[model samples]
Target: MKKIVSLYSVAILLIIGSCSTNPFTGKKTLALVSNDQLFPMAFQQYGQFLTENKVVVGTAEAKRVEKVGMKIKAAAERWLTANGQAAVLQGYQWEYKLVDNKEVNAWCMPGGKIVFYTGILPITNDEATMAAVMGHEVAHALASHGAQRMSAGMLQQAGAVAVSVGTQNQSAEKQQMWMQAFGLGSQFGVMLPFSRDHESEADMIGLTLMAVAGYDPKNAVIVWERMSAKGGGQAPPEFMSTHPSNETRIAKITSQIPAAKAEAAKFGVVFK
Candidate 1:
């Protein structure tokens, strides 16, 4: 009991001490891993990934990716400045690369390292649609989702340790059963919801970002519609999935468009 109490005390202190405010949402978020620690690792891994993959350059598609990525970056700067949160990006070193791959995906690592796979070009064909995707990916980094994920993983591990220690005196079979239950409960209840919330938050922030970058926020809906069509409705249920279902994402984006456009309008970007 004392061991479990100590474990819980440590976890609580870590959670309380390792939090940072999200600039976009003005929410306190977990940040057990700082950008100072996370960025160097992410940059190194990004460099390795680039060297291991075929990086497309000097092509129209590649140029487009760079172009749209810069626009998104600029939009982030503008929003952060306007909100008096520019210091949030002080340590960022932004780089955008287009990689030749068949997987329809794009991602932005911590500290603004971004990659676009050629396969996703079909879905993000035009500048506006591309902006939509870029904004979403960039928002993930801007909101520090990666750091939050790592922090959450740490807490999950701590919880597992607590469970193990608490059950050390139990029969082996009962211990195994308890551990299994904790695994399922933590994953489905805590981790999945945490990830889905990040996705939804990114969608909201990304919509505003694209709009601020002079892209129609409504096109964000179209981009996801294409994504849904591409996936052919072959996704796990929302509760079990790391990302929200396509239908759920679309509905949320649609509902958020008005607010996004209003946000853009503040920066003299108006959409018809």
Candidate 2:
């Protein structure tokens, strides 16, 4: 019994130590891998991806990607620097590429690598809307959602191993069912919900960043309206899906508009 208790205590410590706090949200977040370890891997993988893909250079779309990305990154730098957390990006190699893909998507990798697909341009429409989207992607990187996802998966695997060991003498079929149950439970409960939280946080932060960067925050709501319309007459409900854009989110943004406007003011921004 004493041995089992000690093992459980160690497990809890591992869990706590694996987490990092979000400076923006003041929330503890899972990050099994530290940036010291993760950033190098992310940077190398980003380099490899750029090399393998048809990375557009000295093109209109490429220029736009870099323009919007730099603004958002500058805003992030200001926020981080003001908060005295400049060391968070000590080895950051910020690169923005506009890949020639029509997937209508964009993403930012850890350590400040970002990509925007060309197809997303139509919906993004203008610089402000583009800022909104880029801000959202940049926010994801700052929030470390990918790192958090990896941490959650690792924790789930660890828990499964612990359960299997604890019930080793049980039937194999029972153990298998337990494993499956654990997997699904982890996905639907911890992983999916955390993913949504990250998206929402990104939306909030992105809204403010774009506004500060002299882009209208109202375009954020419009972007989501278009995103919801893209659901193709069938979606698993915003609450059920990973990306949410139903009325609730729109309403939330509307509610936060005043504050976003205030943030923009600090940067000498006034919506046009």
Candidate 3:
């Protein structure tokens, strides 16, 4: 019991000590791992990924990916500067690459390293739609969601340890049952919701970012519409998934378009 109490106390203190406010959302988040520590590792991993993949360079599609990524990066910088959060991106080493892969996906690693798989370009047929996806990916890095995820994972692991320690005096069968319960509870009840919230937050931030980058905010909805159409198969229920359902995302993005456009107007980027 004392061990369990001590573990809980340490976890609580870690949470309190590591809290940082997200510049875009103004919400406090766990950041137990500092970017100074995380960025170097992320940069190295990105380098290794590029070394292993067939990077498409010196092509129209590759140039488009770099062009759109730069626009989104500049827009993020401008918005952060205007909002007095420029320091949040101080360690970012921005790089954009197009890799020859069949998976329709793109991602931004911590410290602004972005990769676009060639397969996704068919869906992002133009600059505006590409900006939408780039903005979303970049927003994930900007918000420090990766660090937050690591912090949460640490907490979940600590919770598991606490369960084991607390149940040590009980029967082996009882301890095993509690461990299984802890695993399921932490994953479904905590981690999944946490990840989905991050996705939704990225969507909101991405809409404003694409608008600030001179892309029509409403096109974000169109981008997602294309995404949904391409996904002819079914997805797991939203409760068990890491992303919001397509219908939920479309509705949210459509409703937020007016506000995103207004945000862009502050930066002298007006949409017709």
- Among all candidates shown, the one with the greatest lDDT: 1
Off by over 4 Å in 1: none
lDDT of 2 by residue, 29-137 (tens): 8878877787899999998988888888897767887898889888878777777766665767788888878797888888778888887888787788889899988
> How many steric clashes does model 3 contain?
0
Model 3, residue 206: distance off in Å is 0.6
TM-score of 2: 0.90
Model 1, span 175-229: residue lDDT tens = 8998999999999999999999999999999999999999999888998899999
Worst ten in a row by lDDT for model 1: 1-10
Model 2 sits at a Cα RMSD from the real structure of 2.3
Q: Each candidate: what lDDT?
A: 0.94, 0.79, 0.93
Model 3: CA > 4 A from native: none
Q: Show the colliding residue pairs in model 1.
A: none
After superposition of all CA atoms, the RMSD between model 1 and the true structure is: 0.9
TM-score of each: 0.98, 0.90, 0.97
* Tens-digit lDDT track of model 3 for 49-94: 9999999999999999999999999999999999999999889999
The runs of at least 3 residues in candidate 2 whose Cα sits more than 4 Å from the true structure, single-residue gaps closed, are 1-8, 238-240
